[model samples]
Target: MLFRLALAMGRTLQELRATLTYAEFQEWCLYYQIEPWGEDRADLRAGIVASTIANYAGKLRAEGSDPALPADFMPYLERPEPADPSDDRHLTDDELAAWADAAIFGIPPE
Candidate 1:
């Protein structure tokens, strides 16, 4: 059932990005062999949306640098308060689009 449920879920960055927290995102990333960030802080500073996590994942894929998010992203992910943490960390509507401009699509950060 669990496997089926997981299978039922769409296999795309957009799909997985819908329901993820910082902790969950980190765990998922580890499973996919994408480190994108520290385990504890993976999603900690990322946004709770597909675009944010997906952006970083996209960047990693493009860089051909698996096992880690852009080591550069942690700062944004850890931005100070009133900052929507995710928004502060990931910084949507900016370089992310450029970072994720991959040639081909892949599964979510896992």
Candidate 2:
């Protein structure tokens, strides 16, 4: 997946790895219609849902009708705040373990 992303972005894998933060990588994945491996399922699902709605809106506009989507209808279009890498606070071992279990086992972590 990383190789494909690198090719699509016209960047070498080393450069992509060196330059992109995780969030930026995800944004690029979405732009290139490539799914990021190991992305949270809920986030992927939300993207799918939003894409569907946007497509439907496009169809309606093509038919000479206004869908009148709300200003905030597509929240995914907004850029999220960049993560602060220098912050010392981070997820605990237990929280990381729980997230891994949730991703692998399809169970929500408590």
Query: Which candidate has the highest lDDT of all?
Result: 2
lDDT (Cα, tens digit) per residue for candidate 2, span 60-88: 56676555343324344334376898978
Off by over 4 Å in 2: 34-110
How many pairs collide in each candidate, listed in order?
10, 0
Number of clashing residue pairs, candidate 1: 10
What stretches of model 1 exceed 4 Å from their correct place?
1-8, 11-15, 34-110
lDDT against true structure, model 2: 0.63
Poorest 10 consecutive residues of model 1 by lDDT? 101-110
Deviation of model 2 at 72, angstroms: 41
User: How does candidate 1 score on lDDT?
Assistant: 0.44
